[model samples]
Target: MAETVANHILARLREWGVEQVFAYPGDGINGLVAAFGESDNQPRFVQSRHEEMSAFEAVGYAKFSGQVGVCMATSGPGAIHLLNGLYDAKLDHVPVVAVVGQTARSAMGGSYQQEVDLQSLFKDVASEYLVEVNVPEQLPNALDRAIRTALVRRAPTALIIPADLQEEEYSPPEHVFKQVPSSPPAELRSTAVPPEAEIARAAEVLNAGTKVAILVGQGARGAAEEVRQVAEVTGAGVAKALLGKDVLADDLPYVTGSIGLLGTRPSYELMRDCDTLLIVGSSFPYTQFLPDFGQARAVQIDLDPGLIGMRYPTEVNLLGDTRGTLAALLPRLTRKDDRSWRETVEKNVTRWWETVEHQAMLDAKPVNPMRIVWELSQRIPENAIVTSDSGSAANWYARDLRIRGDIRGSLSGNLATMGPGVPYAIGAKFAHPDRPVVALVGDGAMQMNGMAELLTISRYYRLWSDPRCVICVFHNNDLNQVTWELRAMGGEPKFEESQALPEVSYADFAAGIGLDAVTVDHPDQLGPAWERALNADRPAVLDVRCDPEVPPIPPHATWEQMKATAQSVLKGDPNAWHLMVQGAKTKAQELRRGR
Candidate 1:
């Protein structure tokens, strides 16, 4: 039998060592679907419930696996559905290759069913590389380039295969005019190091300052040891950007948890008080959260030269691999004999954790959302991988969850999109089948898509060596994050029509699908509920009835923000009294445990 372009594409993927391709089926992709069966699913077809979930699962797999994630969808609506998740990958800088089907070539301009201008559709999202395979000969080179470009740029790339072209007889790029050939599959590796002169100057800036603060991001994942060594030598406090929450263990004395709005007090203070800043592999936006310009000398090291020094006014920009740049900078840095600043930072971190614990234990309508994460933190496996969805749940995951040991964690960091929480956990499970994966999601997100993905878990859990995938849903009957945002940022009362969420029993849904399930309406039930979910022989859902009014106040909440909240309360917010009481109690913890 002659190999079709679809068969050849799968062969190429296998050659590139792609174990699974997250996808959904449609007639436009019938050729590839048929190829999957003919090839005996060599590169497994991991069917997701939706095209968007497929893209997100790929992003999750790529993020956790440190490899390029691939997702597939059919033309038009299926292709359009992939945009959000692809944008999530692009913004968060995850390497993902989106292989999407297109309408038949003859029918493309005729506006046939499911026919859409895919090239223009994918242009912005897959800006690094976007190609439409017009012939069977274009398959290998185009697909290969998509994967390579995605890995090299750490962004989403795309290949649009027309329906007719996919079923055509496979033909290699001929050794003739206009033919482009690609080399065999292999990851290109390089360790870029900044020039010695720049490294020396960066060191001089560090040595001259009495206080140093280090910020790490996902780019620093490979440089954890170097970051730790540099921090030790410079007597610096390390603050993690949310995306880099798992870059360094939270147990580290000077590792001030996440920075920016969802940041710890110690992290905010670290930036406010530091005389010098070393940003390692983090392009953390929110320059206001960084040290005041001209108040501190700064050095930034990043793999992408384009991102270097863009976030802050860095005196030295080292465009190199974070691990290598830090390695070069470490030796030049003199040990700070004045460890007073380091001591202060560590003390602040300690007090912040204490305050976090107190806040998590504070009274609420039912379960404190913070306590849900706090309980998980206490019992989460040393080798677990955790993901969080954006919302009030993220606030608790950021503050209350303590990342330690081999535990990995991430969320929709740059995009801050909802619905990736459960999908990311599923991807993490596929990436590391031996490890337990947990997702902290809000009720809004669960209702949006997380619940449907539970069936995906149910289908795949038996294949995993460790069947401990937990989706912990914060079951507050409101879009709590935006509700608070309206009060704190917009000075508007919670407009119940838009903010309220229709309540649904997530645990019941999970149980119906033949997975472990538990619900926690009280703080006392949280720890036990987490235990059951984490130890379940299959995937489990923890539907926690968290307090909707428990505010996710920033550690360094501005006076204007507080004023706005007050104004909203005065204007008659639905849960004004509960919001005030919860906010007061939560803030009191920080005050009582002051550094």
Candidate 2:
């Protein structure tokens, strides 16, 4: 029998360094599924219980490995199931290639069973690229374009392949019965560098300012040393966006934690006071948290020109690779010897951390979630990969989990979707089998997606000799973030029942799934629980009972926020008073310290 288009596609996937593709089976994609069955385990297809999880797993794979993630689904609903996770990849600006099956070519126009116009459905989400392979000859071209577009644009791309075309005998433009090559031409990749004039202009703007602040984002991941040097020579303090949290050690005198609602006090102060802002590869959407336009002159560095001034108007825009632009601009800058501004920022960072340490150590009946993040920050392996779900768990992780050198991590990014944590860990573990993986998820998000993906981990987990992956669920039994948001907005938690979750025994569930599990209720057991989770030879779940009332305080609370919180307390909400007191004690104390 002649080779089929599906076989050719699978062969190409393997050659492109894709060892696995997250997928779900359906009648529409039987040809592709059968092709996988004959590939001798090359480009192994990982069967996820849900198509959404498969896409999320693929996103997780790309996030940790810096490679294009691949995911496939059958026609119609299976294709639609991928939209959520694909949106996660699109918003996060990660590379993902989604291969979606379509009904037979003959059935497409007639609207046969499971036939849907996937290209139209995926258009907005796959803004970077989307194509259909209706002809057998279009397979190689579609695959090449989709992969290249995803890699170059750093966004999700999609290919809709009809069942009839997929099963047809593969025939290339130039080949008869020959084996087709899988990988595309190597020269299709290039790195952009900003012009010398642009770099010089950015440096001039930096040199003109006495008090400079640098805002770093995910784009600055590999340029850590250059960023440090730039901060040092320019006497600038660095504040990171949540996605860029791991770029520098939190202990650095000038390094501030995440900026925004989950930001550190030092970061808030940095943005509020800087005379000039040097933004590196961050499109931080919250302009209110940024310095006022006229308050600070700005220079932004980004690979994409469209994003340069979209966040904040800039005096100079440098378009190029982050590391290269910074390296070239360093020499053009006039070094600042004045330590006064740097010292003030460093002092603020110190005080902010001191407050953080206090909160992390605060004794509560139920374990404080921040303490879990703090302990994990201390115990995280040098080569670990960490992920967090959306909600209070993400907020706590953003605030307390300090990133160490060479450690990799991911969150939902611009999409901010929940339930990707466990899938991310599974993907990371597959990418770096020797390294440890950890995921932090909330009770709400855990029930949404973590439970199913945990089973996914259990199936293929034995592939690794040292399968050390920890899934830490903050089992607070409430939609804590939403509850706190209501209070922050001056609404009583009277509707709290709507946001409440049914009690779940995640530890018991994990034990039933063939993994060691532990439940940490008291603060004292927190450290020991983490220790056990980290060392387990199999995947482990640490279900920690954390306080539902502790608010994830904003970096700087406005007068209006204080009023809203006060009103909530006056409304007879059980936990409102405690939350208000916590905020007053921590953020209010920071304000007093500044005074």
Candidate 3:
């Protein structure tokens, strides 16, 4: 049998050392699906419950593995379903390659079944690179460029393959005038660094300030030691962007937790008091949480010239690899003799944790949501990989959980989309099958898509060397994050029709699928439940009934926001009294700890 385009595409993927491709089946890709069996599955085809989950799983795999992730889909609807997750990859700057099937060339202009203009559809999300492979000669070059562009640019790319062409005989590009050939698979390496003069100027800004603050993002993941060295010499306090939550251990006395709306009080204070700022590899968008403009001299170091100096005003913008630039900047900086600023920052961090602990122990109607993450933080393994969905659960994951040791974590950072939490854990499992993984999700997200992915887990969990994968669901029958946003941001009462969720027993569903499961209603049961799930023989689900009225108030809530909440209550919110009581109790913990 002669080779076909579908066979050659898989061969190219194997040459690039891809281990798996997350995808779902359809008639449009029947050629490729058949090729998978013929190839002996060299690069395993990890089937997903839906096309959206396939894209999300690819994002998660890329995030954890530090390699380009690949996802595949059929034409029209399958291609359309990949947009949200592809946008998540684009916004978060994760590298992913999407391989999609299109209608046969014969039926394309005739408006055949599942026919869609995939090029116009994917133009924006895969703006970095997008192409349609017309002939077998286009195979190696097109697929290779897609992978290389995704790796070099850290963005999503796409390749559209017509259904009929995939089953046709393969042909190599000739060494003639119009034909183009690609080089063998290899990673491009470069070390970009700023000039010494600019590095010196940045050093001067840091050395001159009495109170220095450093902000790190996911871009700083590889330069942790350099960040710490710079902080120690400059007497700077470190604040992490949400995406960089695992870059530095919270155990460091000078490391303030996540900064922004889902942020720590100490982080807010760190920005308010600093005289100078150094932003490394972070494009944290909320500028209001940063130092007041013109009040502080700032310097920024980043690998991408496009993103550097855009988030904050900087005296010097060093466009270089974070690890290399920070390593270069270290020698130019002079140590601050006085350590008073560092001492103050550390003191504030200590008090903030105490307040967090106190708040987590507070009483709610059935159970406090913060306690779910707090208990997990206590028992999480040193090498665990944790993922959180976007909702009220993100608040506790940001504030209550402490990241330490070699633990890795991520979510839909820039997009802040829901439903990736569960699939992310599955991707993490494939990336590091020997390590334990956890997903913290809300009921709204679980119902949206998390439950179906559980079947995917049941099929694959036994393949993992370590079988601990826990999905902890915050089972409050409400769209809790938007409910709070309506009151705080829109000054509107909680509209039950849109805000309330229908209750579902996630534990019962998981148990029905032959996985370990538990439901916790009391605060005391949280610890034991987490322990059992984490130590289970297979993947587990934890469904805890949380209080819907508990407010996720921001640490630096403005008077206007407070006024809006008050107005919403007065305007007839259903749980006005319970809201006031829970808010008071939660806030009292911080006030008492401060005193």
Candidate 4:
């Protein structure tokens, strides 16, 4: 029964149904690397170019696969490099288990080489569950606990095993082997649905108001049909938080695209004027987007009881699974025949699409970013998974890229971190190799993380059955989102010179890596470039030189925002006048529409 600690660990992962692991090797974990290489029936280890990207790939795996993603790295700086990607999973509430190698047990407290306080480093991000396997026997119990805790808590967990312990002989206990035999118990899965009485109370609260709006988030991904039913019965217009963007079809008549900063006009209107708010599985933190206090009666449904009223005041808190709660509540509600509210919102959606289309068709000196996103949207194959880096490019993707309900994608979510889109696309392609994967990245984000990670894509491109991945790099030569934020904060663009980036040919870089690549500096070449990349036999990058000066106007702007933008124009900002006019027109139109 004797076995190496690494073997026991691999066996546990196999038992947990983990088929793949993302990792990067270093000298500190030579023992684990060798053991994994020699073991049979072990998880397929996909080595990434960087430890940071390996962890990001893990985050992406969890996002697309809906399973506990497994990733490993050697100790010291290797473990530290995992913090950002682990934090991405933490903020998004995804399950991920990080197995980190540590210095030898004999070297403890001796200031050994590459030694770091991993527990302290991971305390805040992986606080839900973290432990070190101090001895060989503890491996069985620790692995079981860490894996199950990560699943149950829906958060990242870390298991640090000293290299010596990893190489030591061990025998797993009989009972310990049965501890994590399969998926989490059915009780844990079904316990999240609220009691029938709670569902009834929520239904009553929802039925009391004439104008109701439903805002959903990532928690409602599985309850799309149920959400539609609830919205139909209550005459509610549906609005999605960014994470929930793929949940409901964007083309649905009653569905409003995203809410808050990068939201649609209909969504802003829906939240601004609704008499009742029925939030399902969403904790949209922007108070400005929600109806003011006392303006709407609220009912919130969430699996986490602690977050029920954290965003808005709730009259009835339905603590349950979104699908279960909505199913139980639907029968108790009366259907509304009047379609005025929904029709009005739909009108706004129609006008908004027109505005979006017009903007996408806009001609400029440097190519408009929206034009590229629009063309990509039109050409993106069904069920393709797409990701957008955080920046102005995200603004375009959030507003323009029409999401087909079957398509799966994600951003940095609550972390709102940059440099994850390309890594996310890499992970998604690995998880579902048959599906096409694309990343839309701003110039700054492309250089920040996408540049180095492109090498990882090149390394693994030929290994997969179908390597259909494309990175659409926005070569706008500026941190466009930050520049706009600076203007909105009443600062002149002249003083924010640090936001500008030196131009680089991402297409050339990709081509040099043996990828099929093209650069588009004119609108006429955009469609052909996208077509070329989409049909490439290998990974590709469409380096698009986009206009950095075009303003990404928010769906709704405050008076102070308007004033700040006006001030920036007076301060001699190049694009401020254009932005000011755009904002003024939107504000004036909303006022006329009775928003």
Candidate 5:
């Protein structure tokens, strides 16, 4: 049987188990669609309002499923539009494959319609790039290798398929394709970190301090047990970066809380007062949060050797597996109760937690961002899977929510694309259907990417992002209030142009797409809407008309951000003393809520 290049490409994608593809149309890419129309093997084609959003939808799909997501675009402006999503996927290590239809094959590198170097445009973002020059053999080889690199390396990849190749009739080689291997957990090395002499010196310096603090990042996640062990042996209080939220349980007695701009009182006070700070598995981007090494000694250990001492000045740098290093450190430490230090920090932790929890349950006429997150925190089963799309909504969920249970889970579009909230929720529910899945998506974000992706697959499609999925979108009409703050600075607020408050009734759109959707305009209806969504076996969308008046606080804010804090007003301005008093009240509030 003869197959066009487009058909062959579709065949490869089907082999990859890709049933959902998000994209926008272009002249050069028409043949690709035609090829799908021509065959029984048509992959699910979704039309995204914007190209960047499509890429984001892809990453969201990938992050939850741990499978490579596929997206497509035509040359020139269409291809350029994909950069934002591509970068997001690249940074977060989500596997993706973009099928970008390029300038006609004859144009090559010379002047031609929509001719820009797709290779160079995507070079920094993707781990692998392949331009299909051969319609038959080379194209298939490129497709296979690109998928392999993306799935195996856990990075976004690209293939620039020439427009002409899509229309070329060719025969595919006869060979059954096997999916790629799953990434295995890393094996621990048999050696210690920083050598015996360095360890001895580090231990001596750390032991000299009356107040010792620990900061654990995501890189510390795998070594959680080892971290607890070392903290017990060393008597160090613990905190984490926002990305490391789940690295340890929030209620771990020694666990102070999250640190950095979004950090709490327990972490901030300890950091300010500690004579020694130990950083593990985290290269928290903000250097301001780190204490001065001249006053307090700092020691860091990480899996990536290059990260040590790069973010902050360090008295000691230990390079190796974090788990292994901690394992080694556990035995060398002498435990002494720093009653004064622990008692003081623990009080602050308690007081500060209370205030945050109070704001979470605040009842305003319009729904406060806190209420939305708090309600979500309450209704969602402890084991429910949570997926986040990029924006303030995602940051808020990561920061304020308290997740419990051994089987609890959350995935972020660490790639930073919006509009993935709904579709990713769909994918996550499919991945862990027995466990309820809730996707928190902003209204602005849901419009850009997920609207069509959800609307496109209305009926039974078990494979592509699972049609059985259900998600709740916190509908906000404006673009990211967080990025708007960033743009207020001199920096270019990239991707802001994609924001659209579509007038279309999202619930009606969902209905049109064959899924149950209900919009909650008032707070009274919100709870019932969510309950109904949870009860349904088929995929459903609960659209809560979120208050655009309330702005959001991101996980990592800057000194600049502190000035802009308007969502809630405490007893005093956020000066150091004010923070201590105010933060204490916050902690007390959280403690009461937990009870």
Candidate 6:
């Protein structure tokens, strides 16, 4: 006998090493949900408040653990709601396997309630997709391929299982799916690296320049130490894209800052003024911010040949994985002549620290958002997984928190999605419960998709797991800021205009569901409250109060601008919104600075 479509789906997930699959019970997915309730080896199913939250939690798992995160949702609204989370995982290079239930096979194409072109809807965004229609044979192949592609491409994949297929009866024994690796390119192993002369020439130019900077992108993940070696040899500072934050640890003395919109001034100015830029791993998107031929020369190293000249004009193109390229470059490169370059960058950093960072500590009244992230950075174990959502909280943590070991969080570079923090933390903590997890979420994002997962963690606490593995988020009450800011770019911005729940409390809400909760209104109150919540032996939440008027980040920012990130200066035809945005990026109080 064969397994049912739902059973086959469960088996396929197990083969991918998924211990749990996040989902919400629904009509379209009821069969699979029932299968989960019955099976012994079934991935521990986490019933989420909403489907989008499920997807996001899975994204968290995949990104932090480097394993595929599995999520499931029913057809119609549930499946549609997952698009944002799916796109986030895709952009962030998390290997996610999402199973979306559709109407019965007969009703899938037409004449079904809530039927939509899900495959077409998600095709461009998902790395791979399959409309699973059978139990034993088709599901085994389809889901296996989906999982494998997600891992290989380092992006999200999907399996759309129709209701008929899921409910169909079949054999008893399950065949666990196994994906055989396809043949590597013929030249994969034999391809020798380029000559040492190329590296030497690039090194010579790098060493010769008094001011040089390294640019790392998403491509820098595993080559941190190597990049540091290159930085040490070059005596140049480092700047990274948002996605590349973890490529090098935040405290590396050579780091200047991150670059792009909401990027710091030093990186923009340094890259703009510096004589040479070393492009590693990343093919960063914001080419307008990149220095052209007038001020800087670029030497780009990437494994993808197509990416060589796609962004910035390249002075030297080294084609290979960053690790291989850096390893080869290190041996041939000479120690840089400009030993004072790091000192200059460090000086600027120190000035930034005193003027921006220190003043944040002085905020005594409504606890400054900066102080919260900074304090969290100091309080949490360095290696603890720190995830942040969009808007103010995200901007604060990204710029303020110095992320430490085996750490992974959300950074949807250009998209800047909301509701990422809690779900990502859920996934991160679930995958690595031994690792402490903390998420700093805004009231806005918390309301969107994050609040739904409160019970998910609560259930885990019931098992005596490390309750500290998940941080509680009761974000500031301005719960629709991300949607409002995003409206200017795309849709209507009316969420702030009319909030449905004026008196709703996420902490209370979590507690109502048999979880523990805490609340804090002032910024100063946040640190202690969170510390207590984190130290609690079970799942818990802390509601941190923030002023509704405080902006998430400034569009026009300097170094302090990075954490309270700023956008590019607006057009001179400035509007009130732009003026307000500019003001938000400015420091409220500056400490007296001494060089």
Using alpha carbons, what is the TM-score of model 2? 0.96
lDDT of 4 by residue, 1-595 (tens): 4678888788778878887789998877777787788775378888887888888899888888777888899999999999999999988888899999999889988999999988899888889889987777666668777777777777999999899888789765445553333333222364467788888888887888888999999889889999999988898899989888888887788888899888888899898889999998888888889999999999998987766889998888888788988888889998888878878878878877767777777665568788898898888887789888898888888888888758876788789888888888988887888888999999898888799999889988886677879999988788888888878776565355688787678988998989988989899999988888888899999988887767777887777776776677788876665555554554454455443
Q: Which ten residues in a row have the lowest lDDT in candidate 6?
A: 181-190
Looking at model 1, report the run of 10 residues with the lowest lDDT sum. Answer: 186-195
Number of the top-ranking candidate, with lDDT as the measure: 3
* TM-score, predicted candidate 6 vs. hidden true structure: 0.83
Off by over 4 Å in 3: none
After superposing candidate 1, which stretches have Cα over 4 Å from the reference? none
Candidate 4 local Cα displacement, residue 381, angstroms: 1.5
> Judged by lDDT relative to the true structure, which candidate is superior, 5 or 6?
6
TM values, all candidates:
0.99, 0.96, 0.99, 0.94, 0.74, 0.83
Give the clash total for candidate 2.
0
Candidate 2 Cα errors over 4 Å, as ranges: 174-183, 187-189, 588-595
Once model 6 is optimally superposed onto the true structure by TM-score, how far is the C-alpha of residue 149 displaced, in angstroms? 1.3
Residues 1-595 of candidate 3 have per-residue lDDT tens digits of: 9999999999999999898999998877888988999999868999999999999999999999999899999989999999999999999999999999999988988978899999999999999999999888886999999999999899999999999999999999989887789999997654799999998999999999999999999999999999999999999999999999999999999999999999999999999999999999999999999999998899999888889899888999998989999999998889999999999999999999999888888899799998888889999999999999999989988888899999999989999999999999999999999999999999999999999999999999998999999999999999999999999998899999998888789999999999999999999999999999988999999999989887787879899999999999999999999999999999888888877
Go through the candidates in order and give each one's C-alpha lDDT.
0.92, 0.86, 0.93, 0.83, 0.66, 0.68
> What's model 2's lDDT at 10?
93
Task: Write down the lDDT that model 2 would get.
Answer: 0.86
**Candidate 1 C-alpha lDDT tens digits along 470-563:** 9988998899899989999999999999989887899899999999999888889887888888888888999889889888989799999999
Cα displacement (angstroms), candidate 6, residue 221, comes to 2.1
Residue runs of model 5 more than 4 Å from their true location after superposition: 1-51, 65-78, 109-113, 127-154, 163-210, 324-333, 339-346, 406-418, 426-435, 456-470, 475-512, 518-529, 545-595
For residue 427, model 6's alpha carbon misses the true position, in angstroms, by 0.8
In model 2, what is the error at residue 547, expressed in angstroms? 0.7
> In model 4, what is the error at residue 316, expressed in angstroms?
0.9
Model 3, 412: alpha-carbon shift in Å?
A: 0.7
lDDT of the structure predicted as candidate 3: 0.93
**Regarding lDDT, does 3 or 6 come out ahead?**
3
Which has the better TM-score: candidate 4, or candidate 5? 4
